[model samples]
Target chain A: MTSVLGPLALATSTGALLIVPLAPALRELISKRDAGPLVTRKDDGNISSFAASLRTRCISLHRMLDDCAKFGDNQLIDLSHGSAFVVGQSGAWAGSHHPVALVACAGSVELPAGFQSIADFYCRGNVRCGQQSIFRSLLSEEEIALGNDTQVLRWVHAESSLSAGRNCRLYGRASSAKLLTLSPGCSFERIYAPVIYSSTEGTALNLRTEYAPYARLAQSGIGRTRVHGAMHFPADEEHRGDAVATRNIDLEQGACIFGSMKANGDISLKERAEVHGSLVSTKRIHISSGCFVKGPIIAEREVIIDSGVQVGLPGTPTTVSAPLIHLAPGSVLHGTAWAKTEGRVGD
Target chain B: MLLGLFTAVVALICIYTIRHYCFTVNRIIGQQRHPYVDVDTAEWPPVTVLIAAHNEEAVVGDILTALLEVDYPAEKLAIVPVNDRSVDRTREIIDSFVVHYPGRITPFHRTGGRAGKAAALKDAMAYVNTEIMLVFDADYVPGKALIRQLVAPFFDPEVGSVMGRVVPLNVGKKLLTRILDLERSGGYQVDQQARMNLHFVPQYGGTVAGIRKSALDEIGGWNENTLAEDTDLTYRMLLAGWKTVYENRAECYEEVPERWPVRVRQIMRWAKGHNQAMVGYSALLLRSRNVSWWERFDGLLLLGVYMMAPVLLLGWLLAMVLFYLGAPVGGGLAVLGLAAFTTLGNFAAFFEIAAAARLDGSRARIQLLPLTFLGFTVSAISVSRAAWQQFTSWIRGQEMVWHKTERSRVAPVVLEKSA
Candidate 1:
């Protein structure tokens, strides 16, 4: 019994030692190096990354389509997923009806009035949509012009410029590189452009601010209260510091803050209130009329931008993002106005 | 008395285990709140990148090279390498970089007025004029967009400090480095993100982090008296109602200790520094008003992390003593105790590491999860020793010295940008 047990014990011990450490050792020392290098981009997890990706795809597809033939006349063009009707030169629908997922156009095309196309329409040249035309998405390389009461379900991107007519509903994102003009009563979720005219009722406001009185929040506070407590800027003084509030932080009319502001509750910026920084909230964020917020104004639930409110400057742009965004008439934003759920032009 | 002590230890351990479990779950499926992730275009503040060096001759040049190529405005950026009383070639190499870069590289050589990183940082701050001071260890390699990512949170006034994720670059070097890489993935990928998501206090580790000069001045700058000045500043900023934000996307790579002795020393310093901070701030944290109840609760648990080592040992000793006493250490209590002992011990951390690996999309390395026991054992022993030493030193009125981990990098690292 002793002779048999001794060798068995030794073998078992050796096997256990060898096997237990071997798996980890093998994994550590001999495993394939598959993990990519850790790197970060400006748009690491941006909501607008999807739109950027679509543009990137368009660039590659444009290169691929360079070898293909262009649409000569109005005909039934068969695609991989579905078919597309080539519009006549007079900008009228040709085909009987093709409910396709992807509608790729080689040249400029205009759908007939009252058409509902649940497809991502692409155009190399300028494209125009008819009245009450419903589209899944629109990606145009040159320019895109939507007719009155047009509804875009997902997104619409124009490499040059995009204009939406009155009473239009832009569901997801509407962007352009040069300029984006939206007539009155056009509701939109996300708008991105160098110069975005949301209302077109008023001209752009003067954005350059003299931040002389508003010093860095650091130099304003004494060493004691600078950290030991939350800041509540005096309405009279033009403070330049980030301010956090446990409750509502209502900036009085004509209040100027050179720093950002965050609150647990609502943040109400009164008329003519100017904040040169961002504003974040757990609940609602309301910017009153004649206010200038150079901001990426982010809110958890809702955001209301009043008339004549300029969100960002011309040279240095910012974002005004929320789940629900309400843009009053004459609301100007230089960068992006992203609404996660819903947005309305007028209350 | 033994039974009561045993019960307290078990209760404390259970609370930590549950916290870890909850954090892991929250990290996996919770609504990830990255409020400042999208601020891409802004007039970035002039920042001073302070590289803390101590006998780091082999690694200082790499970080400087990396910082020069960072995606920040050249006019607004300054690189200040703080050489903290090194007898080696650290000062010589940094001075050479200053000569080469001319206006971009500024070296601050500290010879007098106290030792350690905190003191070096305090003395170095006198020369810098930038509002945002970003600190990095001499060995860390930062990404291109790291400075911008770390600075985005400060756009919000509430954020006084921000910490980026620290990834181990010297992975595949040895077993210890691999384990540390996994551990750091867990610590940053899941643990820090969960805290940021839940609106709790995420710790501001000294390196790969930045603090507003204004907030630092208000928080009394660095506490030179404490060994772990970073931990000390984290809690102080908390007590003062400043939010220390964490950006997981802002990643930087550092060379982790490759050998056991180095790792033990590194952990020992951490344990001592963390415990010292806990002793200093635990009571004050509990008394801090206007802060959320969850913040206070999480702060206390985070402060007591290193102290768990001694408590874990005490529980084992009490179990042995009760067995010898022939007491009623039987029935359901015994099973539950043993279950928590063998099964639940460090399972929270294990679950976290596994989830982090899964989240990081490193599925192949998850095969090594079973071997973390060896790493944890060494850590547990080192922490236990450090905690004991820290406790006794307090009783004996002795001060703790800053224990610098000996860097194993024999050659200067090459700076490479992926994006």
Candidate 2:
């Protein structure tokens, strides 16, 4: 018995040493599928209900402006490609040609100069427009102050009265208490123009559409554009032919370009350079202090305007469109600036 | 009796070596690849990201920043940062982010809970609303395409979980990290991808992986008892008849421990948890109707990885004792053959790492293959120690205590500067 037990003890100890670490796992493996709960009762909750609650609080593009100082006031800026909606009694500031949907506005609506006809206007406020302003349809709640020679192709539903100038034509339905000075040869078309009202409930429009034409044109012009190893147009070389580079274009200090400059990559303009024509790049465009671009500037990636840089031609509406647009303090943009991402305005 | 013990030890070593050789050969010859699926960005579903952090104030900020910078649509993405009772500035940093990006970042603070990552994740699981839940370790800095690439596998309905490749960020910092980098390459580039291609069980590493919320709920969320929740989930998901995939393109950078002691502790913890998983799942795997015979075989081998340390140590001791007693260990040719086979088996890992490095275009790093033997030695000791502790704790009916790896105070600063 002693001899048998000696080997038995040795074998048992060794086996236990090897098998003990694996025993718990073995037991768990043999147990029922639900023996060990993955989560306890205290940790369980209605996931769908929680998710639904979170979905309601999800951030939309409109709520993104909550932290911006511009949204603090009752002014609506049309930064998106689609029309901007003024929910309550706010002032409409149309910075771009994109249409404006006014639910109600306490102050006057400011439109760009020489704005003959807008895409559509759903006015539920008192709108005061300048001379020769044509609106496709005017659905006003209170009043509409139009200038001389205005034309409305669609129906006009004015709750109060509409004061129009001389020589105005209402093509479809006109239901207004007051109609100001009537000019001769004003005829209404029998065909009723359907009131085109855009939806403001969905996601903001893709701002990239504003640059699609320019992008397509730039892509096609790639073959014809002269290729240079580098671009450095000094002030002394202002009359040098249009600078074009397939790579990078670097303008030295006080470099003045009298012709259009195109780059496939980045274009960096130093201080006090004057570009008489357009500056276009497939990548980034950096304009430094006191530099001036007389024509439109377009970049596929980013456009950075340093302080005191002036973009776009004077008194003419030019456009600067890119995915990212950075505007430094005191920089001047004389035309429509469209960016997919929110413009970073530096102090 | 001594001769019998010698033969048994030699036989076990021969078996282990042959098994490793087979794996190495299979990895080299296998042309298995994961099924490709083209996913459109518009079809991407809403995903919730959970990052469980504890005393990771130094590196948590970088991961959060990386998460925010990923190319996923903001409205369809939600980030939940779980603070696991960290007594540092981790909570404060998370709080500041929550304040800054309200609604985008939801902060979940656990004041009273079990002190482990599984427990923390279990608590965070309640807040996950999206169909997909992505988890990232606090130390990981995910690439911009991480979210897009990780979620792409879910376009296949059968896939329940997805794992991404992990690359050590500080590979050139020290010898230990360099060795770790080699190990990572071997583990991800060869072992994991080969397993995926061969239709074997592919593991879902806790970080850099995405889990289907429904699948997780069906399995009752994460099991807080197991130290290796990731392994436990991988097995449970498989048992529940859900497929897991490995995505090679979804790569994320993680910080590996630079110090030897820290590496030892980290490896020990892994060994303990993995061994625990082995004991718990080996029978279930063999008995699982969901897996094929080949899968069962591979699963058991993967589980028994930590046990090899003790088995090898015991074999070495038995051989030494037999030599001292002048016992005939084996016939001359048999012993020599066994020695050669065992040597080949031992160097199989080195070959795998070298192959992975070559594939990754880092041929210069393959020169450090000899130094990996040092890493293996340390891992062997750590695994043995952890196994012994596990056995004692099991006998005494005591729960294994969780040991947190101490974070390098200056590593994050260096990483930030480099970035």
Every candidate's lDDT: 0.78, 0.64
Question: Best candidate per lDDT, number?
Answer: 1
Clashing pairs in 2: A25-B279, A25-B280, A26-B279
Cα deviation in Å at residue B281, candidate 1? 1.0
Model 2, B94-144: lDDT tens digits are 999888887789888888879888999998978888778899888888776
Could you give the interface RMSD of each candidate, to one decimal? 4.2, 20.1
Across residues B169-231, which tens digit of lDDT does each residue of candidate 1 receive? Answer: 777677788788889999999999999999898999999999988888878888888888889
Candidate 1 chain B minimal-lDDT segment of 10 residues: B410-419
TM (B chain), model 2? 0.93
Question: Whole-model lDDT for model 1 versus the true structure?
Answer: 0.78
**Residue B142 lDDT (model 1):** 82
**Every model's DockQ, to 2 decimals?**
0.29, 0.01
Tens digit of lDDT per residue, candidate 1, span A1-347? 99999999999999988887566546555764533334333334333455566455445444334434343444455655455543333344454465655555556667777877776667777878788989888888789889999999988888898888888999877888877878778888777886777666645655444344434443323232232323344454576566777777778788887777788788888888888678888789998988888767888789998888887777667777777888887777777777777777873
Count of clashing residue pairs in every prediction: 1, 3
Report the lDDT of model 1 for residue B78: 87
TM-score for candidate 2, please give it: 0.54
Q: Fraction of true contacts reproduced, model 1?
A: 0.31
